[model samples]
Each structure stands twice: as C-alpha cells, then as structure tokens.
Target: MPRVIVVEDSPTQAQHLGFILEEAGFEVVLAPDAETGFRRLNEEHFDVILSDLHLPGDSGFDLCRRLKADPVHRNIPIVVCTSEVDPVNVLRGLQAGADGFVTKQRPPAEILGCVRRVLQRGCAPEPSPSARTRVTFLDQDFELTAGREQLLDILVSAFEDVVHINAQYRQSAVALREANRKLEQRNLELQRSVESERRAHEERKRAESHLIQNEKMTSLGQLAAGVAHEINNPLAFVINNITLLRRDLGYLEAMLSLYREAIAPLAVGRPELVEPIEEYAEKVDLPYTLENLGRLLERTAEGAKRIRHIVASLRDFARLDEQELKEADLNTGIASTLDLARGRASELQVALETVLGPLPMVTCYPARINQVVLSLVTNALDACKPGGRVIIGTCVKEDGVEIAVTDTGTGIPPDVLGKIFDPFFTTKSQGKGTGLGLSISYGIVRSHGGTIAVESTSPGGTRIVVDLPIRPSPTAAP
Candidate 1:
C-alpha cells in the first residue's frame, strides 16, 4: 500500500484527512505542522505528502520548496490541500514544486484522484539535456575561413539550445492545461450522470412497487369476498337460534307464572301443604331466573346482531363488489375497521376507543379507505403493551376529514420512524408481519390526494394522522 503523510495543524482536520486516506487503503502518518512534517520525512520515505495550505508557521508553499530543494526528498510528490481557491495561488504552489493542488472543500474522491495522478506522473521527470544533437550549417566552410568563426559558432549553438528548450516547455504547459480542462468537464459530467441514474432508479422502484400493490389488492379483493360469506353463513344460524331460544324462554316464563298463581291458592288454602312447594322453588331459584332471564336473552340477541354487522363490515371494507370511486361517510369506514379489529384487540388486552366527529361525506374509494384504517388500527394495536390502549378517531378538518390512530406503546424512534412507511420495512418479529401494511396504506392515502404524518415521543406513544381532500383528486389512479 502507498504511504501518505497528512500535514495539518488542526487536530480535527488532520484526523479527518487521515481517516479518509486510511479507509482508502493507504497508510497515513500525521504531522501537526511543517516542522514535524519535515521531521517525519527524515525518519522514513513516503510515496506522497498532503499538506494543508495554512499553518502556524512555514506554510505549505515553504514546505514544498524545502522538500524540492533537498536531493533525497525531491522526488516525493506533494499535493497541497488548500482553502486557497484562486488560480494564482495554485500556480504559486506549482511554481514551488508541488505536484498537485486540491481544494479542501473537494470531496475525498477528488483528492485521492489528484494524489494518484501525481504518483503516475512521477515528480515531473527533471528536464535533462539531450545526450546527442546534430547541428549542421550550410555556411560552415565560410564561417571556418572567417577569423571570428569560433565565436559565431558558439553564439548560434547557444541560441538553438535556448529556442529548443523554450518550445518544449510551451508544449508541456499546453498539454497540462488541456488535461485540466478535460478533467473538470469529466467531473461535471460524472456528477450529472450519477444524479440522473439515481432518479431513474427511484422511478423504476416506484413502478415495481405499484405493480406489487396492485397484485396485493387483487388478492385481497378475492379473499375478502369469500371470508365475508363464510363468516356470515355461520352467523345467520347463530342469530336464528338465539331468536328461538329467546322465544322459548318467554313461553317457559308464562307457564311458570300460571303455575305460581295456582300454587299460591293451594298454599293459602292449606298452610301445611306450602312447605314442599317453597322448598322446590328455593332449589330452582325461580325468582332469580324470572328477574334476569329477559335481560340475558336480549343481550345475547344484541351480541349476535353485532357479529352479523361485523361480517357485513368485512365485505364492505374489502369492497369485493365495488370498483369505482363513491361518496362515503368516513365515520362508517372507521366503525367498520374498529369492528374488524375488535377481536384481535381483545386478545391482546388492548383497549380501543374512538371520538368520531361529524363530518361531510367525502368522495373516495370507500373499501380502500377501510383497508387503510384497518391497517393503521392494527399497527397501533401491535405497538401496544398488554394493558395499553389504542385510540381511533376522526374529526372535521378545514375541508376534509382527519383520521388518527394513536397507540399507548412507546413511541417510535426517529431513525425507525422515517422507514416505517418504506416498503418491506418492519420492526416486528419474523413471520408475525409482512412489513407492507403501512407502506400500502401510505400509497392508498396518497392516491386519494391525501397525506399521512406521524407525531411521536418515547413513552408518550405515537399518533399517525391522515389528511384527505374533500373530494377525490382527478389524477388518482386505481
């Protein structure tokens, strides 16, 4: 690996530069100032040296000149890391024998490339005189005959050498300028290419995500219809059986009443006969049964009706039968989602509460809205501890409804919160979640011309609020 020395007075800046070089697979040595930089150079050779432009004493230009002046260290390439951005300062550094100049503000890659090029070029091969040169003059014989021939020949040859050297230097400088211009242009093009590629990648990812969501919606549409039907079928018998049981209880009550009336007269006619009847009534708890039977039957019927309503809700929320946008009461959608989640919420011992405000009907895909609600509610439930509670509520906004699902669990951390809506991101244990719930919900809300936002703090819980337009956006897609 190449060894690099970073001479920077600021400890922080030196450490940063050292880290960059080290991570790039270069061995880095640090020097706090020019004096220390020279001390390290004497101890061991380095492939390259990077020095900051500004130092307490002996600035980078002075160091570059000193290194170049020393015969032993003259070959070591030095790159100036400078805040001095003016072209004149750069030329001054080059004149002092610095191999390259890099602005401190340039990214690490740019600096690394600069150093690499300096190494490739290898300390600007010290310009040397050609070993052999052929110089012929047509007037050589006449010059030899003249008495001043030797002086004339010496002057001409000296002029030729100076002219040749000047032409070579000019050519080298022009080539260097062209190379620098091309490097600048290439860097700009590379940056633009990177940006364009990033945007294209994002668009492709979004398109793929949309395709996946569409597929999921299709499967959900199919599964929801069948599930609703299956649940409703058993619920129908339960409702009917409860109704019949309630009627039978009434008949049994009436018969018992008549029997009581007859027995009362018998007891009054013969006090001795009342003992056995009283003992039987006490054993059966007849008075208690008569008092509570109607209430029990009424509650059972009401519960069965609720089960039926829940089944209907499953179908409505899935909207297996509806394909177009329609005006819907947001309250109804919230209610259905709550009912659908009620069973799981009970199992998890999480209390569910709501405070729905009166709101105007908003045009939307009702089933999709229900799906979003169900997802948000269950996500809240998942976040809750056993004794915690989740609140699902809605209120009227300026021109739309705001649905919020808040949970009593510890709030999401800032880092994780940003990714909660990213597709396939989840904090749940494996197999317990698919990680697509919040992402799909977000897409649904966005497609309806709405926004979903979250507010949270540790131990204070989290509330995700969704805002929608009063009417569906014309640009919304299926």
Candidate 2:
C-alpha cells in the first residue's frame, strides 16, 4: 500500500480526500501546515503528498519548493489541491516543482487516478504540460482551470497506445499460428511425395532390367534357330552320301567274295592272276577288313543320325517362329539344354550326366523351358572345379514334371544363397557374371506356372530343382 500526507487547513476537505485515499488502500497522514507536514514526513516515509495553497504558515508552494529541494524528500511526489484557480497560483505551483495540481472540486475517482499514475511513473521527472503551454504561449488567453484536463488527456493517450499495441500483438500471433500450420501441412505433403517418387523410381529400374533381359533372350533364340538351320542342311547331305557309300561297299564286297571263290580253282593252272590277287589281299589284310567294313559303316550311320537328332533338338529349343504354347517333353528339353551346355561342361572338365525318367508330353513354352535348363546347367558347370560332375535329371510329378541339375563342387555359401535370385547380386568375380541369370530364370519359371528351388550347404555341392506344371494354366499361357 502507498502512503500519503494531507496538509489541508480545512478538516472537511482534507477528510474527504483522506476518505478516498484510505478507501483506495493508501495510508493517510494529516497535517494542517507545512511545519507539521514536514515533521510528519521527518518521522516516517510517505509515497505521495497532498497540500493546500493557503495555510497557517509557509504555504503549499513554499512547502513544495522546500521538500523538492531536500535530497531525501525530492523523490516523493507532491500534489497541490486548492480553490485558487488563478494562473499565477498555478504558475507558482509549477515553479515550486509540484508533481500535479488538482482542484478540490474534482471527483474522488479522478484524484485517485492521478495518484495511481504518479505512483506507476515512480520517481521519473514529468514536466507539467500546463507549465510548458503557459511559458510558450503566455500571450494567448486560456483558463487556468482547464489545464488539469491536459494531464488527463496525456494519461488517456498512453492507455490508448497500450490497447493498440495489444491488439497488434494478437493479430501477429494469429498470423504466426496460421503460417506454422501451413508449413507442417506442406512438410507432410513433401514426405508423401518423396516416398511415392522413391517407389516409382525403384519400379522403373526393375522394369528396365527385365526388358533388357527379355531382349537378350529373344536375340539368343534367333541365333539358335539360324545355327540349327545351317547345321541341318549340311547334315542331310552328309547322311545321304554315307548311306550310298555303305551300299556300294556292300556290293563290292559281295563281288570280291565271288571272285575269290572262282580264283581258287584257277590258282592251280594260271597262278599269275591268283598270285597278284593273293599278294594284294595279304598286303591289305582282306579278312579283317571284310569282317569290320559292315560294322564301321553302321557306326558312321549312327553318328550321322545322332548329329541329326541334336540339330532337331536345337530347332525345337530355339522355337524362334513359335510364340504359342505346345506339347513338349521335359526330358527332351533337358537333353537339348544339356547338349547346348556340353561345350561349357567340357571346358570346365565337369562330366555331364542325365537320368531322364519317362514323362508325358506337357503343354509348355519349350524354348523358355530350355533356356531355364541351359541357365541352370551352365551355372552348375561354372560352380564345378576340374573333374567335377553335373547331373541333370527329370522325374514325373503328380501335377507337374521336375528337372533338377546337381553339381559336385563347392556349395553356395548360406549368406549369399538367399540373395542369389535377387537382381544384380552375384558372388562371381566382376564381368564373369551379370548377376541376372537366376533372377531372369526365376521370372521365366514363374511365368511358365512353375517353381524353382535350390538346395546347398558349404562344401556339400548344390542342387537346383525346377518343378513345371504339365500344362500351363489357361490364364498363364501366352
């Protein structure tokens, strides 16, 4: 609570001000003159002082000057209240350093308001606006009673400025909140867009890799077809000529037999013809040659037939002109693939063995199945060391046929075995492998309505099994 001193000569007026100050939670002290007021001030501290212009001794103006001049009392605010509204009296209050001048006729609320402002402003110097107006425009006529309104005006203006600043702050707060909300929304949207793009990028890359794999397979099919045709043409003529040579040799041998029988009788009389013929027969080993000539021709004919069979398998496996599914023997396809991979097996010194079980013809894409077998067999050969063995076997299944390629070599490591079918993952060094063989083979088998699996352990060798449906599903067939 603030403390105030009342230096009024009239008890009624002084008591009225004291009632208002006391009601407003201030400690009130009363003195009738400057002398008594100064004594009370000397006894204890007071926050504000109220005094009357006319007093018994040393009036309010003189008290104001004296108190303001004192180093100890100068900080306390002094307010002058009197019926004297004359300009000279107001000017005298101003010169004496009075903090404020309020007429005794003013309302209690306005008086209390002035004291509140004075307390809030504290010990700062507040020059009287009315004093400045009087000094600057002395020639202008103005009523002294109206000067108090100027002080209220200054207080009202300060309150209005505070209200305006609060309103502006509220508006800025609302704008900042809206901006933060929008920024959070944009950040979420950006995150979603980034995730979507990442998935799309991955899908595009996979599609690209699949397309390249398909294109290579198609080109390879074409090459195989052309090679088969070139080999078949020459093979036909070679077989036909071998057949003719075998027949002519049979006729010549029969005639030679007849001549030797006739020469047996002529040898007693005319030995000249017999001697030359016998010498030629001895030099040529005629007995052994005649015995083996028929068997040699048969072997040559068998070799020709084998060559013809291999060529036919190559043609069926290529299937360059055939796009639709057809009846195919898995055993035959495996044999064809084995034939194709034989060169690689030979180079790696891996023996190729086949155990083809009796299997019914299944409707399938023969060329694609052959490709899968070839890839599997080639991989097995690659895994083998010198003198290693690769076995390709086909067996009958309840709903499909199984082709398995087993190799006797170092097995696939457990850690890498899982990723063997993943695109671009490989254990083979550098350019030795593209890492797409098993991945493409997996896709091919799936497209054919089949499943392919591998089994291997460290140093135990590896076995790959392909289980293909006897006939592709109606929806799966192309």
Candidate 3:
C-alpha cells in the first residue's frame, strides 16, 4: 500500500485525514505538529507528505523549505493542506517547495485526489536558477529562487483550481437562485391561502353576528309585545273607570246643586236641619273638591296615555310587525329610538334633543333602521358626560333622507376612529361591550343601500350620519 503522512495541528483534522487516506488504501501516519511530522519523515520513507499550513512550532511552509533543501528528503512530494485560500498564502506555499496545494474547505475526495495526482507525477528534475527573483505582491515583497518550469507549473495548477472553483460556484449559484424562486412561490401561495381563509372566517363571523342580533331583536319584540298586552288590558279598564267616575261626579254635582236650591227656603224655619247640612258641607270643603276633581281626572288620563305611548314606542323600536322591506318614516324611527334610549339618557344625565325636519318616507327594513338609529344614539349617550347633550336629527336629501346623531362628548381619537366599524373592535372596557354594534349597524345600513359615516364636531364632539335611499335597488333587499 502507498504510505502517506498527515501533519495537522488539530487532532480532529489529523484523524479525519488519516481515515480518508486509510479508506483509500494508503498507509496513514498522523502527526500533531510540524516537529513531530519532520521527525517522522526523517525516520521513515513516505510516498506523500500531507501537512497543514498552520503548526504549533515551525509552520508547514518552513518544513517544506527545510525538506526540499535536504538531500535525503528533497525528492519526497509535499502537499500543503490548509483552510486559508488567500492567493498570497498559496504563492508562499508553492514558493516553499510544496508540490501541491489543497484547502481544508475542499471535499475529502478532492483533497485525496490532489495527493494522488502529485504521487503520479513522482519527482521533478532539480533546477539551478541564475539569480533569485524578487517580486512585490499585495504591498509585500518576497524573494524566490524557484526555476521557471516550477513556477510555471505552480501558476498553471493554481489557475486550474481557480477555474474549477469558479465553475462549481456558478453551478451552486444557479441552483440557489432556482431554490429561492421556488421558495418564494411557495411563500406566496401560503400567504394567499392564509388571506383567503381569513376572509372566509370574517364572513362567517359576520353572518353569525347578524343571526344573533336578529334573534335578540325577535325575542325582545316578543317580550315587549307580551308586556304591552299585559299592561293594556288593565290600562283599558282603568281608563274606562276614570271616564265613568268623571261622568257620575258631574251628575252628583248637579243634583247637589238642586238640593242646595231646595234647602235654601227651609234655612229660615228648619234652621237646625239647614245648619247641620251647611256645617257638614263647610267641613268637607265640597265646593273646592268639586272644582278640582275634573282637572285631576284629566291629568290622570293624560298620564295613562303617556304610559301607553311608551309601550307603543317599545313595540315600534322592536318592530316585529314590519320585518320585510317597507316604506318607513326615518323621523318616526328616530323618535322610537329616542324613546327607547330616553331612560338611559336620563340615568346618564345626558340631554336628548331632536331636530326633526320634513323627510320623505324611505323604503327600508324598519327594524333594521331602528336598530341603526338606536345603536348610534346609544353610542352617543355612552360617549357623553353627565351634562353632555345628544341631538338626533332627520333631514330630506335629494335622493334620500339623512339621520344624524350628534353628541357633545369627547371626540373619537384619530387612530381609533378609522376602525370603529371593524368587527370585534371597541374602546369600551372589557365585559361592557361586545364590539359588534357599529359593525352590525354598518351591515344593516349597507343592506338598505345606505351609507353611514362619522365626523368630529367642534369643541370635542362626534357626529354620526346615516344616509338612506328612498327606494333601494332590488339587490339591497334583505
């Protein structure tokens, strides 16, 4: 078997090189440094010397120069093994009488191939140069005494290695670009898929939210209807009894007046009987009581009517009777919303005002319109302080009617204003908001071919305006 010595300062590199050469059917001798390698080389006859450039004591360059100068070891071929790829270092290694050069970064097979090629070349004839050549390279000066053929061989070999490395780099570069292109394509596909899934999820969530709000409105309508029914029956009898009592009180007053006329003549002779009747009348204050009784009944009836009006407003707000598309007065819807939100306004001490202008009836989903109005008004009230005011107004537009809810509250922050209609977005404290009010309202308005927008008002306030078409296209129908 061909014998080779590997001089490497690193134990791992020495073992690795040893393994590769031994597996290639070569006898391997491992040396930790140049001193040990030099001793080994002098003691034994080796076919090849694979020495690393970096050593503990003398470097591989120094060892090569010393061996080439010695008569006994001058014929042995030396290959410098290193990780350094600097052209200056390569030239220096070749100038040191190294027959071949291989970098550690090269594949193991390439390193082994380099050694085999040198072995095949055997030994070169010694040349005596006329004079040493002094050259300046990369701002450093070096004096070399190698023959022209040796120098030519070194340059050609280095140039060949450069050409081979360049070809490999080009192929690697092409492969890498193709890989990156495919990776980019894959990433784009993944992004598109994720975006599509996100849109689907949002659509599903929107549908579910609409359904839940509809069910809530339906349930509210049923409850309101039940409450109205329960209250109306008793209210009817109370109203009837009040009417009857007022009529009977009028008859009794006339009869008492006639009795007073009849009793006046008896006052002189039947003084005791007239005196008892007059004293009882004076004690009871019958004259004042008879005068105020009519007014009292009228006020009581007015209060009962107010109660009835409120119940009607609740039913109107829920609008169970009008579920489909129909002509609805926007002003009336605003009124119903105001009525429903009145208690909350009162509790919050927020003033509620209406600037209702003449408006043409808009064909829309009445319940949905009412819901939009209620949502806007409720949000307005919530944004306000105790002394703040909310104004709900309706006006006629050229193509439709506009409902505006303006509040004297802190205006929405610039950053938060844009995302107000985004689903599940809210500024309210957790548990206090579901964050779907404006989103649902926006959907509702759009379904009716309407547009809802908001703007900041003067002196820290907000105004939400909803514009609804009088008669929407068929596509807008829910």
Q: What's the best-to-worst order under TM-score? A: 3, 1, 2
Better model by lDDT: candidate 1 vs candidate 3: 3
Worst 10 residues of 3 by lDDT: 122-131
lDDT at residue 233 of model 3 (Cα atoms): 92
Q: What is the number of residue pairs that collide in model 1?
A: 0
Record all residue pairs in model 3 with backbone atoms less than 3 Å apart, i.e. clashing.
none
Models, CA RMSD each? 19.3, 18.1, 3.6
> Per-residue CA lDDT of candidate 3, range 305-336, in tens?
87888888888888888878998887887787
lDDT of 1 by residue, 1-478 (tens): 9999999999988998898889899999999999999999999979999999888899998998899889899889888887635545554665566677776655677667677767665676443334222233443211111112222332343354345456767988999999999999999999999999988875775676677877877887777777777877888898888889888888998898887788877887886887887888899887887778888878888988887787787777777776788889989888887888999999999999998989899999888888889888888898888999998888988868899988998788878988888777888899998788888888889999999999994567999999998897799866
Better of 1 and 3 by TM-score: 3
Q: Candidate 2 has which clashing residue pairs, if any?
A: none
Compared with the true structure, what per-residue lDDT tens digits does model 2 show for residues 1-478?
8899999999998899999999999999999899999999999999999899999979998998898678888888788886734555655666676667666765688678767766665543534555444442356443222235435543463454355456767988999999999999999999999999988975775676588677877888777777777888888898998889888998998899899889989999899878988999999899888878888888989988988877776776777777789888778778776777787888888999998899999888888888788888888888889999999898999898898989998889889888888777778899898888888788778878899999984467999999989887776643
After aligning candidate 3 to the native by TM-score, how far in Å is the CA of 100 from where it should be? Answer: 3.0
**Collision count for each candidate, in order:** 0, 0, 0
Cα distance off (Å), candidate 3, residue 147: 2.4
- Per-model TM-score versus the true fold: 0.58, 0.55, 0.85
The best candidate in terms of TM-score = 3
lDDT of 3 at 318: 82
- Native-structure RMSD, model 2: 18.1
